[model samples]
Target: MFNKLFGKPKAKGKDAKANVKTVATALSSMERINENLDMLEKKEQILQRKIAAELAKATEYSKAKNKRAAINCLKKKKLFEAQAEQLAAYQLRLHDQMILLEGAKATTDTVDALRSSAVAMKAIQKQTKIDDVDRTMEDISEQQDNMKQIQDALTGPVGVASDFDEDELEAELEELEGTDLDEQLHESMSNVPYAQEPIMSSPEAAVPIPAPSKRTPPEKTPVHDRSEDEELAALQKEMAL
Candidate 1:
């Protein structure tokens, strides 16, 4: 349904622009591919010529009985054949890409034509709506101005609330100052230094001690009688005379 309304839904302007860029890139790539193909073709022709020359030289050497030279020429011919096969494969790949690029070119041209028609139709519609667009723009500007004024009225500095009570705040500050003064006075009075008292002597310190008394020696008595001792001795002497 949208395709029917929009005339097959032609490519957007941006898509058309991208398609143009892709076409330019594809063209450049095609040119490089053609150059490569030409180089490959030339290489293939050179290899064919070299192969033919080497085969002829090998045949002549073999006829003359130079086996070593003939074998070297055969090796050269094999190398040329291998190179020619590789170039043929490269040519086939280039042909395939050229066919694909041709198809893409046709599709790009068709899309470009459709986009051109769509752009023309869009330009005509824009011109027809010019008056309506101007009126809408004016209405939007008026609404924006009214919105800005309302926002400013709500958010301005003088519109904000005050959080402090002046009289109550002043009384609280005065009470705090009186308390601080009383604390300072009490601290000063308690911190003053006091005088120290001297120690006194007691009466017990003046008393003297008494000396010890002297002791007398004991007397001794005689153990035997002297008169008895003398009578014994006289009787003994008379007997003897």
Candidate 2:
């Protein structure tokens, strides 16, 4: 995504390896020089001991009255001092050379480190960009939202209509319930026996009932009216009793 933002990396691996190799070589040379300096120091110490021994021999010779032997010993001591001075100069030159090489090695190593760091920074810049990161985050958020919607759709209740009216359904259910109750009441009434009105035994009732007369059948009454009449008859029977 960020390829266009940073371009390609430069070629520097071979150069870095070469610099490291040079530094290694210089460090090795410095180590050898230090070793030589150490050897020179040891030689100087040995020469100092020899000079001391020669002086002691000269003192013994002079005490014994041997002037010629004492003079020869002093000449040998001078020769040893000259050699020690030359060795000291050589050791000093070696120290200088080692110091210079050590400094060069350190410089080379520092340059290599800086170069590696720059390369790493360049590579990182090539692989990332602020705009790309922002776009990617936005895309991730959008995908999450889409996934949530998809999951809701998949897991949502089936066969459940959202467009229907709950109030209407409730009202219809109430109507059905009322109808069922009415039917049950009707069934109960049908199951019960109707009560007969009792005949009164009062003086006002001395007139006998008339004989049956030819009359047309009564018109069919509504079921509710018939039920009401039966209930009224049952009440009347109770009152008569």
Candidate 3:
């Protein structure tokens, strides 16, 4: 029902990789450098073994008093030492090149990442405008107001209850309160004790108190004597005799 007042989102696709060197190229270069270093290291070890062998031959020749053979062996050992030093220098150069290549690769990756971010930001900014944002915010505020009105309507009192007069309710409540007050006053009056003031025996305030009244008992009814019945009984007894 409120569809026209709302907005949706848009999804952007990943851009194609630009003219950066591929990972395979960097890996191949690193592998080639490492292989060269490894080969140089192996040659260095072989030259070391050869130099040791030449020195040992020179020592044996010197012990046998052969001065010319000893001198030749010493010269050969010096040549082997020179070759080993050259191999070490080559390994060092290769190591330095590998470090520089790695640093270059990292710098390239960082630059590429920043460039891609800039491109994405530009695309999004082109798709969205300040005017569009303002309009969307206005729509959201209007929708919120509309929802609040709906909630108030839903929660409002209904039917006769809503139609009740406020003034009449207030008047009825006041009347009930007045009646309750009157009853409370009446109860307080009934519970209160009556106090009579003492009258001073003076001419100005001589009020007389009445004496208590004495009740008289009722007189008994008169009764005839039983002498007549006794005399009749005595006469009947003489007759029966």
Top TM-score: which candidate number? 3
lDDT of 3 by residue, 64-116 (tens): 99999999999999999999999999999999998887786666556666876
Q: Put down candidate 1 lDDT per residue, 108-190, tens digits, no spaces.
A: 66767876878899998987797888999999999999999999988855522345667988999999999999999988754
Q: lDDT values of the candidates?
A: 0.72, 0.75, 0.72
Candidate 2, lDDT over the whole model: 0.75
Global CA lDDT of candidate 3, please? 0.72
In model 3, the worst 10-residue window by lDDT is: 1-10
TM-score of 3: 0.58
Give per-model CA RMSD.
30.5, 17.3, 20.2
TM-score of each: 0.43, 0.49, 0.58
Q: How close is candidate 2 to the true structure, as a TM-score?
A: 0.49
Q: Is candidate 2 or candidate 3 better by TM-score?
A: 3
Better model by TM-score: candidate 1 vs candidate 3: 3
Task: List where candidate 3 sits over 4 angstroms from the true fold.
Answer: 1-32, 65-68, 167-241
